[model samples]
Target chain A: MKLGVSLYSFAGDLQTGALTVDDALRYCAALGCEGVELIGEQHIPNWPNTKISDLDHINDLCKELGLEIFCFSYYMNALSHYDRRATMEEHLEMVRLGAATASYLGTRIMRPAFYGVPVENMIEMIKAGLPIAEKYEIIWGVELHAPFPPVYYIDALEKINSPWFRLIPDFSCWQTAGAAGHFQANDVETLRPLLKWTVHCHGKGHVFDEHGEEPNTPYKDLMNILKEYGYEGAVVAESEGWITNYKPTLDVVKTHFKLLEKYGR
Target chain B: MSVELRIPTGGSYALTEQFRELGERVAFPDLNLHKVEMDGMKGYEFKLRNPWYTEFPVSCAEDMEVGINGYAVQKGKIFFVIRDQAVPFKYAKNLYELQWGLGEVAQVRMLDGQLQAVVKEANDVEIKFLLRTAFEGYHLPNNRIEYEFKRNMGVI
Candidate 1:
């Protein structure tokens, strides 16, 4: 499995103007990351209305750095309306836009978080965007976050059993420690069944121990499970320590990469 | 020596109490508020941070109230600035096209003469608005959550 870093890990720095998008990509490259993930809105200036020139510049930069753009994450705010949720057409348009951006970034995987939207609505939106996904040669990886087990989306995944539709199981789901009760841990074995559908993954890390290991997540077990299932996709290191513990993101991200190197298969 | 009985009421507990009190008054963080010049009018500008993980439209902002040093500014005097276009706060609800991207900075500028008194080097700022989050309002009573952000920040 290839190890990578998500630009979302440096959200704090990006928001504070401490790091530009170029700076972040270079930082990931310097860390010896073979690939990187990006959140469209976070890294792309004037996102959804993104300029082709900017996209081309980013593509060139990644090529220059020899870093693969593994995945581009998207967020859908279905509740953007004041009195109602966004229409199906609106959501589908967003998907198309996201897919276009992901295609331009030279990434085959797109992870979208449909927060506040029902699963049924989410499925419908994905189904509507399948043509766009196909056209862009992009795969949709629905993120499996905490408080919800992998089984929560099994029926949905089975119903829409297309290669284009898959899962991106976050390590936070298998967290045995460090969440402080905000999330419930799912048995590591539960993820075994969903491995076939997982195209990408989020290696969510919070606080690191003195030994440069994540105290909250079982990285070794997670790596073993992915390896056992023949999952060779990129495991992107995503650090939430900046938001949770107020730790410097650069420091936490560096430690996370080391932890990934130690356990990443 | 006689032992003096002392009630421990300091450290984290005191700090927590102070925060609780401050929480009731402030709406957003100090870093989000800045003093800027817009249209040659010098005043304070407050950035609207997407409270949720995903991006939402600026139209979701409703019933906004801005307080500077304990004085509330009239809604007519406030403007919601996104993409360099400023719309009156009262009419922001009709702007369905203005999307506030995640981690993107959108400003609420109070540049009228009314703010001249409080828009100084350092001031107390408070912003309160009801965020119509999905269908939470339809299912629960008074669940159209009102977000309150407050900070005593340097505006220079």
Candidate 2:
């Protein structure tokens, strides 16, 4: 699988002026990652409304750094601030827009999260986004998150069975030794079935210990699963440092990427 | 602790009155939800549904970001929407009775390096009532033309 760093991993760095847009790109290159994912709203200049000139700048920066733009992450909601149909329609539009944005960002994959969204609503979103995905040359999918599992979407994925409808498993699904730190440990067994449908992995990492490793989740078992499955996709590190202070969150991210390379196969 | 609101574009969106107040009160940074069609949603609306909290271990996760879209600011004032108020869910209570029913004052307590807000689990529908009224109190700055109805309602 290809190794990458999610701009999300360095959210702290971005907010603290420790890294600029170009700086983030260069950091990933320096770390020897093959690709990068932009949270889109955060790192991209004029996010949610970026100018072509800005996209050009980002494209050029990635080119100079020898990194491929792997994925773009965005958000989707199912709550009806209005009526149900209105909410569903709005979300569907977001899928299309997110896909178009991913195409502009030079990636074919766009990740969206639909917290509390019913599976039915997501299915509708997939159907609505297919045409746009085909038009934009992008694939729109949901990230497998907690409180919700990829399994819940199994029927939906099977029903749709399209490349545009897939899962982006964040290592969040497995119990790294740190399952307690985030959410409860998911049955790693539950994740096996979703592998064939997974186009990318969030490759999440938490606080590290004195041993210079994440103590929360078991990386070896998680990596072995991906490797054994014959999976070969981007393992984009989505680091969340458990330390409160300005700990080098990027270090944890780099470590996660290296671990994936070592075992993610 | 820092909080970030990640409002998505490709639709109309506005901040909740209470959330806007909190943002202003706390001086949270502002971001433009750019290239958006101001006409995405014709009027301001709020969802009574609660946020899905069980999706992730938010306690140990990084900063929280709320996404919004296709909602337009009606008349210069953002339309107020009710978010999950951490209260027990109920239905059918009128706003006035619900307002009078508000209870459970909260204080943020830090336990194990996490910010925890302890509030009494609201019984009945008062939480929604209190939340709905926050909209009664807000008006976007320099957007008086839209909030004129509030002045007529003696809401000021």
Candidate 3:
């Protein structure tokens, strides 16, 4: 499996202006990442309306650094309309934009979080977005994050049985300890059944012990499971330690890369 | 120099403590509020962080109020700036077209001439705003999360 880092991992530094999008990409290269993921809304300037020149600049920079743009992640804030939920057309427009951006970045996979939207609506949105996904040659990975089990979306996945619509299982689902005290661990076994539908994965890391192991996530077991399932997609390291632990983002992400190296094979 | 409280309707104290720790880490030790002249008006500007884990639209900002040396600058006087475009807090509700990128510092400017009195070499600054999480099913009363950043900062 190829190891990668998401620009989202550098969120704290990015928010504080310690690093630019170009600097973050170079940092990932310095960390020996074979691939990298970009969050459109976060990394792309004037997103959903970002200038083609800026997109071309980022694409050229990635090529210069020898880092593969593996995945593009974006959010669908369906409830951002204030008094009402965003209409299906609004969500579809976002999908089109996301797909176009991902296509321009030369990434085949896109992960979207349908925040505040119901499961049924999320399924419909994904279904509606499949044509755009196909047009852009992108695979839409519905992130299987915590507070929701892999099995919970099995029905939805089956409904949208197109090749373009798949899953991006975040390792947070298996977190057993650490800063994620509020999120109960989802049965790791449940993920085994969903591996067939996963096109990308989020190697979510919070606090890591002295041994470069995350006490919160069972990476060894998870790696073994993925290996057993013959999954060979990119495991994008997403450092979230800064969220609650206030740890340095670069340090956490570096350690997370090490953890991925140890078990992400 | 920092104090933060989460008025969660029914969340765990442990989680609240975690968030408090988070607030402390992300909080700027110095208010970093600076004096600037914009549109021929003397004003105060400061960098604001997107406190959420993910990016949110500028429209998500609601009921914003800024305090400088105990003086409160309400919504009408505050503007959230992104990519050099400034939108007033009161009008940001319908401007979901603009987003606050994660780790990207957006400027907050208060142009009300009254702010001139509170601008000093070093002042206590506090900014409190309601952020709409906009998650459909997950309810936080008023569909908003409240955040406050208070610090004793030196003017640059």
**Best-fitting candidate, measured by DockQ?**
3
Error of 1 at B145 (Å): 5.9
lDDT of 2 by residue, A53-169 (tens): 888888888988899989987655332121122355666676777887788778989886554245676677677667777788787667765434446677678888888778887
Q: Which rank order by DockQ, best down to worst?
A: 3, 1, 2
List, residue by residue over B1-156, the lDDT tens digit for candidate 3: 121222234544454445445555654523677778777988888877666655677777776888888888755778888779887878888877777766556778889888777778888888776777654333345455667777787877
TM-score, cand. 3 vs. native: 0.87
Error of 3 at A170 (Å): 0.8
> How far out, in Å, is residue B6 in model 1?
44
State each candidate's clash count: 8, 15, 5
Question: Cα miss at B59, model 2 (Å)?
Answer: 26
For candidate 1, the per-residue lDDT at A25 reads 90
Per-model TM-score on C-alpha atoms: 0.82, 0.61, 0.87
Question: Candidate 1: which pairs clash?
Answer: A1-A265, B26-B149, B26-B150, B27-B148, B27-B149, B27-B150, B28-B149, B28-B150
Error of 2 at A5 (Å): 0.7
Instruction: Return the TM-score for candidate 2, rounded to 2 decimals.
Output: 0.61
In candidate 2, stretches whose alpha carbon ends up further than 4 angstroms from where it belongs are: A77-86, A176-183, A242-246, B1-156
In Å, candidate 1's interface RMSD is: 14.4
